[model samples]
Target: MDVLVLIGRILFAALFLASAAGHLTRTKMMAGYAASKGVPAAVPATIGSGLLILVGGLSILLGIWADLGALLLVVFLVPTAVLMHGFWKESDPQTRQLEMVQFQKDLALAGAALVLLALIAHAGTDLGLTITGPVFDIN
Candidate 1:
């Protein structure tokens, strides 16, 4: 279980860090995309999103307050997956198909992040404090 968690952490960290860097390095492109998406304040939105990804990715990689990091990721990803990637539901059929595919891919990544968040949240809750199936100590 520990080894699996470690591996999962590494892969998740790598994925977020790479994407964070991509956004930070391409601020203009990101801002342009945001503006194209009809974001009211594209420049600030771009910078804020980039910072969120960078800081949240680093937090996850460091394994310090991972729950908080995951929460932050969820905050960013929900909007991104819904707004920026809403091309599927808002665009033409031809464009929608392509965009929907990309949206689903991004949604998958967001889903992974959400799962990690849930795991962290469950770690200390009554939810995580349960076991099922046969047990010798059952009485």
Candidate 2:
């Protein structure tokens, strides 16, 4: 169970980590995309979001302040989904469908992040450790 939880954390963090790397490496491209989506201060926002994602992903991955990390993810995902994936504003059916898919994906991730935050708060400890303390407690 501990191993599974650790694996889940790693898997959850991987998406944000990879995305942060992409945002940093492809800053110009990401900024251009953000600009097309009408994001104010697109370039700076891209860079800032990259940093936020990096910090959040690392915190979650390391199990250090996972609650804060989850909150960061919620902050990043909500605006991003609404701003970048505005399916309702799309006129083209294909584009609308694609944007809707992305929006749904973002919402799902946000939900997962919220769940993680709730779990961390409920457990009153870092999620890296077993909720019951010992990993293999049989009692």
Candidate 3:
């Protein structure tokens, strides 16, 4: 069970880590997309979000401050979903459906992070690994 939990954390963290890398490495491309979605100061926002997810992913992957990591994920995920994946704004059915799926994905990820946040907050040292750390003993 513990190993499974670790694996889950690794998998979850991987998603953010990969995204962070993309956000950092492909700043211009990502920024252009973000600009298209109506995000102001898209370049900085892209970089900033990249940084946020990088740190958050590290925290989760390393089993340190997992609660904060989960919180950071929630912070990033929610607003991005609402602002960037605004399916309702799309005129074409296909585009709208795609955006809706993206929106739902973001929401689902956010919800999972929120659950981790709540669990970590209560579990403290115990959750330091999955919920917080079997590593640095930091939350």
Candidate 4:
């Protein structure tokens, strides 16, 4: 079971880790895309979002404050889905479909993040054989 949890954590954090790499590496390009999609303060937003996911990913991967990391992911996912992937605002059918998919994906990830948060809150993070035990003395 602990092994399963470790694997699941790695898999779940993979997407965010990859995304953070892209965000940090291609800041200007990503920021331009965000600006085109009408994001205010796109550059800083891109950097900040990258950092959020980075820290969030690291926190979860390291099993330190996984709850907080999950919350951070939720914060990033919800607004990003609403602000950047508002499919309803798209007119072109194909583009709308693409945006809708992205929107759905983001929401799905957010849902998963929320579930992780709930599970951690209820069960506590002291589950069996965690590679990295809970930190800061919180159970």
Candidate 5:
């Protein structure tokens, strides 16, 4: 399980790092795409998004602020999935299919991040330690 957690962290870090680098290196293209998506203040948003991705990715890679890093990623990617990938009517079927697949993958990754964040936040609580009470107890 520890190995699995480490693998997840590494894989997620790599994905974010690649995405951040892409966005940073392609600022103009990203801005254009954002404008096309009807985003207001597209240029600034693009730049800010890139920075958030870079920072969050680095945090994950360094294993520092893992919970906050995951939270930041969730904040960035959830709206991204919605605004960028949710609507598909304008796209060709093949493109839409691919985008949908990517969106699902992002959603899954975000869900995993959230789960990891929760676990990390509850670190002191015995994950396997059970507490008994009248009716509402945690185990």
Candidate 6:
């Protein structure tokens, strides 16, 4: 069961880790895209989000501060979905459909982050854990 949990954490964190890599490696390109989407301070925002995603993904993967990791993901996912994938603002049918799909996917990821947060909260209560405690801390 613990092994399964570890695997789950890895799988969940993979997307964020990969995205962070992309964000950091393609800063100029991503920032340009964000600017086109009307994001203010696009370059800085991209860099910040990349760092947040990297930290959150690592925290979750290491089972350390998973709650904070989940919270960070929720923060990133919500705004990214709403601002970047605004299907409602699209007019082209094909583009609108694509954006809608991306929007749905982001929402789903956000939902997963929320669930992870809830699970972390429950574990904290049951194991008498604090924010500083590791998720698997049995002591």
Q: Output the lDDT of residue 79, model 4.
A: 98
- Per-residue lDDT of model 3, residues 55-125, tens digit only: 98888887777778888999999999999999999999999999999999999999998776676566666
Question: Which candidate has the highest TM-score of all?
Answer: 4
* Model 5, global lDDT: 0.72
Q: For residues 1-139, write the lDDT of model 1, one tens digit per residue.
A: 6456556767777877777776778878888988887787887887788788777676666656565676678788878877787875665787787778777877787788777666655553322212221111111
Clashing residue pairs found in predicted model 3: 127-132, 128-132, 128-133, 129-133
Higher lDDT: candidate 2 or 6? 6
* Per-residue C-alpha lDDT of model 5 across residues 86-116, encoded as one tens digit per residue: 6465568888888898788878877977876
TM-score of each: 0.77, 0.89, 0.90, 0.91, 0.79, 0.89
Overlapping backbone residue pairs in candidate 1 total: 0
Candidate 5 residues lying further than 4 Å off, grouped into runs, are 1-4, 124-139
RMSD to the hidden true structure, all candidates: 7.4, 5.0, 3.4, 2.5, 6.5, 3.8
lDDT of each: 0.68, 0.84, 0.85, 0.85, 0.72, 0.85
After superposition, candidate 4 runs with Cα above 4 Å error: 129-139
Worst 10 residues of 4 by lDDT: 130-139
lDDT of 2: 0.84
* Tens digit per residue, CA lDDT, model 6, 2-24: 56656877899999999999999
Summed backbone clashes in each candidate are 0, 0, 4, 0, 0, 0
Q: Model 3: residues >4 Å from true position, as ranges?
A: 128-139
Positional deviation of residue 127's Cα in model 6 after best superposition, in angstroms? 7.8
What ranking of all candidate models by TM-score puts the best one first? 4, 3, 2, 6, 5, 1
Of candidates 6 and 3, the better by TM-score: 3
Comparing 1 with 3 on lDDT, the higher-scoring candidate is 3
Q: Model 2: per-residue lDDT, tens digit, 38-123?
A: 99999999999999999889877877777778789999999999999999999999999999999999999999998877776665
Candidate 6: 10-residue stretch with minimal lDDT: 130-139
